[model samples]
Target: MKKVLIVGGVAGGASTATRLRRLNENLEIVLLEKGQHVSFANCGLPYHISGVIENRESLLVQTPEKLKKRFNIDVRINSEVISVDSSNKKVVIRNNGEEYTETFDYLVLAPGAKPLVPPIEGIHGNNIYTLRNVTDLDKIMEKLKEKSIKDAIVIGGGFIGIEAAENLQEKGVNTTIIEAAPSILVPFDSEISNLLEVELMSNGVNLLTNNKVIKFEEKNERVVISLENGNKVEGDMVILAIGVTPDTNFLKNSGINLGERGHILVNDSLETNIKDIYALGDAILVKHFVTGQDVSIALAGPANRQGRIVADNIMKKGKTYKGSFGTSVIKVFSLTGASTGLNERSIKVLGKKYEKMYLHPNDHANYYPGATPISIKLLYEKESKKVLGAQAVGVKGADKFIDVIATVLKFRGTIEDLSELDLAYAPPYSSAKSPVNMSGFIGENIEDNLVEQIFVENLKDFDKDKNIILDVREEFEVVVGQFEHSINIPLGQLRERYNELPKDKEIWAYCAVGLRGYIAYRFLTSLGYKVKNIAGGFKSKLKI
Candidate 1:
């Protein structure tokens, strides 16, 4: 019988082991885990701190004994793979201070990633913690119970850090998130991400952007974070949720090709450079589904799928993983943010000729109670008209919008395909024209040259003397705010006052959102006036 030895018993390793057993009952599968728990919901770790996930046992997806009986696979916890001898197809493992060698016909490495704890002064304080697994969660839980966590500081603004801060605040603890970037949730473009930032601040979560911690020191029984800008913040506890690095140090001399950041280099089959060796999960480099560039996306969805693919190839079933789309969604307090494919910043960096448009639509029907606005941004290749990426932010419907785009990306579909998708609709669930459909319609218009649009970021490029900024919103709405040097002309009064507007200069029109502005754009264009709707209108301008 063929034997498969797997290292790391989380999403990728656990899936591979059970899958191997399912494919062939006679196969020998040995799964080694460095941690005590073989498989647990690492994503639910933060929710546990907030008591949202009250039952700790519920997080453990499977136990070693359970796997042994159900899948007939040998599961060993606390057995750390110390080194890999790829040439000999063997691994050195340490368990309870005892070393042993495990030889296998096939070896799968799925050692995921470890929390990146920077080497800074006083970082080793007892109150400083990094959550990665059940062990890490246990320590944090114990600290919460053992001490009074009055104020907490999260030293990152990514998914884990944001989630941790939200949960901490739910526990009635004052939480502050310190991020080095200009904004949080880097996956979403700045305008969309800013909406989330506003939500965080409104919910009593202190957020500090464009800041980094220089050092840590314990003062008055609290951790003092000294910022690089010479500011100090005191907190009872500090979470080092900065980021993660591939946990591939043991394979340094194992002859496996690794990326610059130590991510294992693997082919489409999940096969490493070494013969009979495979790698999957966050520790491996994968091609970007849209960009076709080698990148590292530490997402659970792709890792889970990659696990099944690796098992299929091991059984000689022939499966190929084209790439990962980096599709992700996060709930930050009341607002949710989601994105898939490339953002505008990335498109610019790649020097791709792209066109983008933005829209503000209700998550559901305006007639329905409790309707909230969703900010949607779509990016596509100008030449191919192919949908490159999209982002959505709102109280709800973010996941739905991004999921649709992610599916379209999988089929390499174009913007027109999005418009033609017959999505289900109900007053409480979605608008008559779903946000997805609205985005498609808008894209189709741009593609067909029905109307031209300009973004607020490039408003300065329009010469003041040569271009007229027209606000199509009602006078009452303009009381709240209006763009600088913009003229107000309500859509209802545009027909009677069309002649009053300048016919020589270009007309840049906007409203509360894009619908009215779009209407004005078409009405003016028919009368032979140069007109362009500012994307997303005043709502998007507010975010910037």
Candidate 2:
């Protein structure tokens, strides 16, 4: 019988074992997990800390007893894989100070990731916590129950940090999120981040951006966090969620090839450099679908898929990993933030040729009672018009929109496909045209030369130069708000007032949304003038 020894047991390892058992019933499968629980929802940790998941047992997806009985797989908890001798096809496991060597025909390494605890002074204090495993959650939960942790300081405003802060706030704790970057959720664009920031602020959660936590100091039973800007924050507890790195310390001398970020290097077949050895989940560095670069994505979705792929390959089937778009979504207060593929920041870093468009449309029809605005941003190749990525932020259905875009990106779908998508729609659920379809409409215009556009960031460059910034909204709308250098010329009067406008200088047209600006662009372009529609229009500008 083929012996498959799996290291670690969570999303990746557990999935691999279960699938492998279904594939080859006679195979000798053994799962070794360092933690007490073999399978649990690590993503649901924040919600559990907030008391939203009142029962701790709810986090346990499957206990060792359940897994063993259901799958007939040997499951050992608290058994850490100390080292792997790939040449000998053996794994050194240490349990309760007793060591054992297990030989395997195929070895799967899913050690997962470790929280990045920066070398800040007093970081090892009792009040500081890092949430990665069940033990971490247990520690935090115990502290919350025994001590009066009325205030919390979460370092790093990524998904975990934001979620942790929100959950702590739900538990009546005054939470503060300190992000090193200029915004929370670094994966998203500035406009989405701005909206999320507003949402967090409105929820009584203090958000501090452009700030770095230098160190933590314990004074008089209070934890004081020192920021780079000479600001100090006192909190009852601190959560370190800056980021995570692959947990490959045990493989230091195990002869497994690691990538630049210390993640295990594997090929399309999920096979490591060592013979008969495989790596998956956060421990393995996989390809980024859009960028075509080996990048580490620690998301659970990709990890689960990688596990399945590894299992298929182990079954002697020709299966390969197609790479990941890094599609992800998170809920912040009332808004849901989601993104897929690359954003402007990534495109700029890669120096790739790309065009972007932002559209502010209601999640559903305006006539719908609870319709909320969804800000959608799409990035596409300027030459090919291929949809590269998209980001959406709104109260409802943001993730659904991102899901559609992610599917389109998977097939290398272009802007034209988006326009022609036969999407299901209704007044209560969606507009006559879905937001994805609207995004396609805008992308199609840019592709067909029907409109020329400039981004909000480029507005500063043209501000100094002489240009006719036309606002296509009504006078009443302009009275309520307008850009500083903008002139109110409603779309209805633009045809008659064309002669009064300067034909020599550039004309940048904008309205409430990009729809009216697109209308103005076609009109001015037909009038034989140098014109560019302000992509995303006034609403986006206001948010930015």
Candidate 3:
């Protein structure tokens, strides 16, 4: 019988062990976990703290006792694998101060990652937490029970930081987020992140952008965090959510090829350098879905998928990992934001030529009673026309649109494929033309050279000496807000008042959204007038 020893028992290891057992009934499988709980939903920790989850036991997926009873696998908790001896195919395991060596015919490493704790002064003080596992959650919850927390300082503006801040605020803590970057959610385009930033501010989050914490000081039973920007923020508690590094330090001399970020380098089959050895999850580097570059997304979904692939490959199933798409979504107050594939920041770094179009469409038919506006951005290669990425923000259905586009991106589908998708439509759910399809329609127009469009970022530096900015929205819409030095000319009145405009000057037409501006552009362009539609429309992009 072939004995398989798997280290770590969270999402990656647990899934791999369970699936592998099902594949081979006679294979001896032993799962080792350093943590007290074998499988638990770490992502739900923040929600539990906010009383949203309401039950602590609900987080447990399959405990070690349950796994042993059901799968007949040797499941051990508090058994930490200390070192690997590839020469004899053995691993040193430590449990309750006792050490033992275990030999295996095949080994899998799914140790996952550890949260990064910035080396700042006084960081080791009381109640400073980094929630990565069940133990961390228990420790933080224990502190909250001991004393009332007045305020919390969350370092880093990524997913964990934002979620923790939101949940902590819900628990009556005056929350603040300090991000070193210029903005939060570094994965998304910074320009597109503007909507989320505004939403955070309006919801009473004290966000300190472009700031770094240099040191921490404890005084009068409180923590004083000093920033590199010469500002000090005093809070009762602190949570370090900067990010995480792969938990593969023990594999340093284990003959494993690690990436630049210390992630175990594995091929498409999730096999390491050594034979009969495999690694997956946050600790392994996977190819980027769009870029095909080695990257560590460190997300739960990718980790689970990699686990299944590892199991299949071990059984000679030959299932390969396509790549990590990095498709993810987050809820901020009433708004939800989602994205997939590579953003402009990443595409530009690779010097890839790509074009983008923006649309502000309702989640459902506008005539529908509970329709909400959704902002969608689509990016595609200028030459190949392949869909590169998308970002969306709205109260409803933002995730659905992004998920639909993400599926198309997985197949290297082009902008035309997006428009051709047979999506379901109804007044309560979607429109005759879904927001995603509308984005495709506009993308097709751009791809086909049917419309000339300019982005707002370029419009600032545009040559104001000649090109005119024209607003094509209704007069009432302009009264609320208008572009600088823009001429108000409704699209409906453009045909009758064609004689009022200069014929030789270039015109830039923009409406509330891009629809009316596109109409005005098509109308004026056919009349021998050089015209361009400002992308994303005015009111939607400018935050009405």
Q: Rate the local accuracy (lDDT) of all candidates.
A: 0.92, 0.89, 0.88
Clash count list over all predictions: 0, 0, 0
Give the winner by lDDT.
1
Model 2 clash pairs are: none
Candidate 1, TM-score vs. the true structure? 0.98
Error of 1 at 209 (Å): 0.5
For model 3, give the RMSD to the true fold: 1.4
* Tens-digit lDDT string for candidate 3 (22-87): 999998999999889999998888888788988989999998789988888899999998889887
Cα deviation at 333, candidate 1, in Å, is: 0.9
After superposition, the stretches of candidate 1 with alpha carbons farther than 4 Å from their true spots are 542-544
Give me the runs in candidate 2 sitting further than 4 Å from their true place. Answer: 463-465, 542-544
| lDDT of prediction 2 | 0.89
TM-score of 3: 0.98
Residue 88 of model 1: what lDDT?
Answer: 87
Question: Can you give the TM-score per candidate against the true fold?
Answer: 0.98, 0.97, 0.98
